[model samples]
Target: MISFSPTEEQQMIVSMAKQFASGEMRKIYRQCDENGAIPEGVIDTAWKMGLTSSSIPEEYGGPGGEHSAITGSLIAEELAWGDLSMAMHILCPALFAYPILEMGTESQRKKYLPLFSDEKYKAATSGLIEPRFGFDPYSLSTTARLDGNEYVLNGEKCYVPLAAEADLLLVYAAEDGTSHAFIVERDTKGLEIGEREKNMGIRALTTYELSLKNCHVPKENLLGDPRGYDFNRIMNCSRVALSAMAVGVAKAAMEYSRDYAKERVAFGEPIGSRQTVAFMLAEMAIEIDATRLMTWEAAWKLDRKEEATKEASLVKTYADDMVLMVTDRGVQILGGHGYVREHPVELWLRNGRGFATFDGMAIV
Candidate 1:
């Protein structure tokens, strides 16, 4: 019996996340987008919510809460509804923590999991997306070879969130044709953090390009050493997280356009009363709900510790199209007003366009 209904605790988490999104993130998303920087205070406020640290066990200096993909999806959608950039930025630490928590060795967990429990926001992130055409996660261009006691990494990575400030980075590379994650510490030799990337969307969340020229990390840094971790499962989790976020973005666009249609009158009648406008709005609502359910189903599969590659991939593909359609419809409904910065529909459209490229940038 699959239930889309969230548990009471999940509902509580969603409500809290919605408040943060509406109360905090919504207040400054436009300015953050325009300035290409989110205020530190806002980031600090989100950090206090324990969004990333609550799932770790008490032995790791954390709050000892269960980690659930479904709960993470619910929280992710609400936070993304507030703003994608801030939402991604706030959750970036999880990009590093969750994998280690789930798949790392005991020594790895003892060393790294405690870092996330700190009072301040820890700068940690992952590197997976490369800068190239026809990028595929399975066949990574980055290569790693075991040399002596260290793994020599060689490749370039782009769109790495908070790379400049991060003290730790979980860099994914192809080792003997199998993709694997290596824990690379900041200041490691041959690991060059390049200039911050200028992206078309999610502009406020600073990302960077990286050059790893024979970068050497201890063999012990290999995630799930002695036995490799499941790269497919990680990718599935990432897909579900991003898909939920797409639903959130689309939902935001739909509700805003729907409200605008009801209020923005033309020829003494609300545009929402018109047949074409009503149909478009109806379709947007339908697609957004459909995508949300798809996201939840994938997330539910993940929580069951089942293989969710097919479901995750399907939802991700659908979400990529769904968000673009809904946001474009939002712009269409608003006419000229949607093209301008005065309204957030244009911003949502811009942010919505980047979902297809946002793999490994988020996770649950």
Candidate 2:
């Protein structure tokens, strides 16, 4: 029989992460959102927790902990519950490090993994989403052509987290009609980092658009080098991560609304005592739990090295809708209060709406 219960170690890690989320992320989320920036001290605190570097091997100057997708999903949900923007920003380096750790050549790991093990937060990110009407990760518009010792890259990417500060970027592009990732240094010629983007949600997390015109990277910079990495598997991992985050965001909204309904009286009775409000809360709880379970299943498949494209895709789609529904209900429950910036429900609603377009913005 299969079990979804986390291991003892996993539980301990989750508990630690939960404390950090509630104690640190929650305290300043609104301020960060308003300012459109997360405090450097907060990011450094999270980095000190070794959230992103713990999985690297001892030889690479890390704790050599097992890297499990389920554990990643659990941590992701809790962090996102505290605040989506801070959660994404805290985990941004993982977007670059994890991929390389899992798929990069031995030399690549030796060269890059150590950078993440530093005491300070290292800025590294990925570029996958293109700024187009119908963007598809598998069928990217960015193109890379191998020429002698270098690969010439030409394309535009948007919604790249920390693009302005990232010292390294894993840029995905189509190579001979196949999607592949190329490691480009920050100062690479023809790689123009655009101004920060203003989005509807996750406002605290800085993102940028990039223009690559004949950008050249050493041929060896291709991830996994001689044998290319599995692009599909990478996408699946990202889907699972995003799905878990959706569960977190939805759960936060549900709990907040449920508490409010208990205290806010209408007709001389608490709003939660009413059937309509109670039923919405019940539905929100059920759907959030369902999505979390689905996300866990996908993460489990990834840990087992099983093909999880269909499962990941299904959970991602369901979570995208579920988060929007739950967060909107959160605002609806608060009536006029939800529309105001003072409450977090409106912020969550905005963040929830962007999940559909958040491909590769997160990863497990």
The TM-score values for the models, in the order shown, are 0.99, 0.99
Model 2 vs. true fold: TM: 0.99
lDDT of 1 by residue, 1-364 (tens): 7566888998888999999999999999999999999999998889888988999899999999999998899989999999999999999999999999999999999999999998899989999999999999999999999999999999999999999989999999999888999999999999999999898889999999999999999999999864648889899999999999999999999999999999999999999999999999999999999999998899888999999999999999999999999999999999999999999999999999999889985469
Score each candidate by Cα lDDT.
0.93, 0.94
Q: Name the weakest run of 10 consecutive residues (lDDT summed) in model 1.
A: 224-233
lDDT of 2 by residue, 181-281 (tens): 99999999999999999999999999999999999999989999646488888899899999999999999999999999999999999999999999999
| TM-score computed on alpha carbons, candidate 1 | 0.99
RMSD after CA superposition, every candidate: 0.9, 0.8
Off by over 4 Å in 1: 226-228
Q: List residue ranges in candidate 2 displaced over 4 A.
A: 226-228
